[model samples]
Target chain A: MLEWIRFIFTAAFLAAGIFILIASVRGVYKFDYALNRMHAAAMGDTLGIFFVLIGLVFSAPDIWLGAKLVLIIVFLWIASPVGSHLIARLEVNTNPIWEKDVTAARRTIEEGDTHGHL
Target chain B: MSKRNSNWGNTLQGRFLRWMRFGWEPMDVLLIDKMSQDRDESVNDALSAAENLRDLQLSEKYNADTAIEHSIMQELDEWSLSKGRKIVNRLYALLSVTLCVTVILLLLETVIAMPMRGVAVSPTNNEVSQRYIEEGMEETGAVNIVAGMILDYRAFDTLGESTVLFIAACAVLILLRIDRDKDGRPTQELIAAEEDDRSHEPKSDRILQGSAMILTPVVLLFGIYVVLNGHLSPGGGFSGGAIIGAGLILYLNAFGFAKASRFFSYKTFALITLLSLSFYALAKAYSFYCGANGLPSGIPLGTPGSILSSGLILPLNICVGMVVACTMYIFYAMFRKGGI
Candidate 1:
């Protein structure tokens, strides 16, 4: 029964890992901007590696090794988001996106009037 | 406007067109023909100037003739102003780097060379050792080996180490602490407010958030375990402190800054840091007093392989760990909040 439980847990972790990887790839292809792409990359790094490392920790032979693995997971958890945020900020500052014909939308929202061109 | 248009049409095609339309009236012909010729000459001069500019831009690698002229002018300017400031600056930087490397190499060589020598230099063989041993046994009543060395034999060194840690904690806190009222205008606040107005909003992933929620607790527990078992194992103050700091960072990431800040407030962190350093200092001072005068020390080093073995190592480790963890978290928070 214990062996079976371990096997099922391992399989679940593996599936999660694969799912995250696939989502990251799809997100990269689907996103149009650097900010969106950064989201995908951050997700891939933190969640994708978390699943894999957690699985390995459970399967490892000793407590010391598992503890070291946990350290790596913790480091990534702290670093990945901050790194992605900085990169996205840099991209936004360097190459900003211009709004297209949003004056009518703004006017309608502000004055409760909708006569201008959309 | 007419002159500008004429200049635009001054290439070979424009001259060809002018030649084709040569059968107009005398006044028209003079105006058109003379203007076209002048335009053509001006266009050719502009093209040559543009080419020269491009050559100057690329002259660094291609070794263009104009590059020599530029270098000559630059050299003359350098000679006028003290003759060798640039060279002196370059040589100064080079010398400093070389000196640093040489010093590091010499220190490493000394350390490596000591072990290679067959001389057995024991700390206990010196004159200080006899006095220390007599005092340690009289005060601490511990006889194993390293414990006696740390607690009674070289208590002064241990005291200095703790004092160093306390100073480090104070320095980090002072450097990282934010006081916008005192400073008048904080640069970080300005940058953050500007960034907040921009198009890009902060992004987060729900899936990662979910996983972090589960992992964070486990990491925290392991960190505490490392700190708790520091005396028994090879791990001690520095490693255990780093582990706990990592756990704090994990919590910070799992929950956003607002939530993490709820548990780890600036006031609470500052108080804890002050209290921990005070505790370490008090412990060391008590040991120092006992060793200086003729007083019996209460702290005992249990059997070597036992869990509660080290005389004061465990308590010292815990104090160091707390100071390190608090300072690290404070630094991280300051950086995250753009206090720098």
Candidate 2:
């Protein structure tokens, strides 16, 4: 009974991770802007990976293996954010027409105010 | 006399007919002129009718010829499109069938040649392997038979493999290395282009730089540990060197070549690779000579489990590790810039 319960939990976690990763991939294709695609990819990199690794740890045969799995999570957590930040910076630097694709903060507020006034 | 008169009468009759037909009187002359004019007109009319019939025939024949030519051209076009497509499809199908047959035959040959698993007569139970299993540890002085085999028993092959990698790196360097002036300054145009490229690329993010700085030392330490402990553990020079090389690359990406060059320059890469490879060659040559001459190499095989043990294996692994790490870094540098 306990084994079956553990199996179910692991499967559920893995499935959820897979679903999130798939959704992120879809979002990447659906989003028009590079920044929005990056946002979707970062979610998969962090949350999807986390869930999958957590599930793997539960199914690991030994303590050392489980510890290594957790270490991978920690390393990715540190690495992915940095990677995402660099990519975002790259997108900002390289894209000359980024302003047209994404609205500026000041313009967004003014537009909202105009709408309210109307 | 009467006969003569009769002959004269016949002559007169002929004469009279001639007078009537060729009479040159005024009325007779007018009648001849009218008759000649009518005859000329009738002849002209007949000639014109024949000419018109010839023209109609020529036009009908031309129309039939053009229609036949057009139909033939359309048929040729249809043949080229549909018939040509069918021919191409047939050629491709034949090629695929040939390839599939050849592949299947090759696979079947391999399967037939393979020894049955678990049979005593299998290749795995051969005398050479039996000896290796029984005496490899003692002969090589390493607990890990796999490492001992690679570093000692088959060290020449490993050396060759390493040299292949070195040559590959050299080839890439030759093809892609940036040309510098006598003063070691990169060419002005190349520098200008690089500057333009860098302007478009993002500068290092603070978070990325910070994380890389923190992780760099740890990663390097781990790589060293793996390299040093290769003989006694699961990890070896290849994996360890790859890790260290990756860490170095990550640092370079975060901080850029200017910062990374302080520690690892093109000169440094060249020197390390040259020294390590030379040392490895000399060491292996000495061991091979000793082994061939049935003489001990005089290098002590210290206690197997200790870091300093395994005679030449530890040093060899470190040399391999250095070569690998430098090669990886040089490869990355060459890809990024034309040179390190």
lDDT of 2 by residue, B220-287 (tens): 98899988888888767777888889999888887887788899987898798899899999999999
Root-mean-square deviation of Cα positions for candidate 1 versus the true structure, in angstroms: 21.5
Per-residue lDDT over A74-98 for candidate 2, one digit per residue giving the tens place of the 0 to 100 score: 8899989878887886786557776
- Residue B14, model 1, lDDT: 61
lDDT of 1 at A1: 91
In candidate 1, which residue ranges exceed 4 Å CA deviation?
A1-118, B1-159, B172-176, B180-208, B291-295, B300-311, B338-340
Tens-digit lDDT track for model 1 on A1-118?
Answer: 9777777787788689879978998998899988888899789888998998888777777899989899888877876776675576456445635223354455675686645422
lDDT of 1 at B241: 77
lDDT of 2 at B198: 71
How many angstroms is the interface RMSD of candidate 2? 8.6
Candidate 1, clashing residue pairs? none
Cα error, candidate 2, residue B277 (Å): 0.6
lDDT for each of the candidates?
Answer: 0.67, 0.82
Worst window of 10 by summed lDDT in candidate 2 chain B: B1-10
Q: Please write out the lDDT profile of model 1 over residues B1-340, one tens digit for every residue.
A: 3455556455655656766787544456558678767787778889899999988878755766678879998888878577577788889999999999999999999887664443446543666766655665434434433445654556567557656765765676676555665658766764664365233323243444656666667766766766656655556556667778877876675465666778787677768767877777788788677635645557675664565765676677677677777767767766555332
- After TM-score superposition, the amount by which residue B189's alpha carbon in candidate 2 deviates from its true location, in angstroms, is 3.4
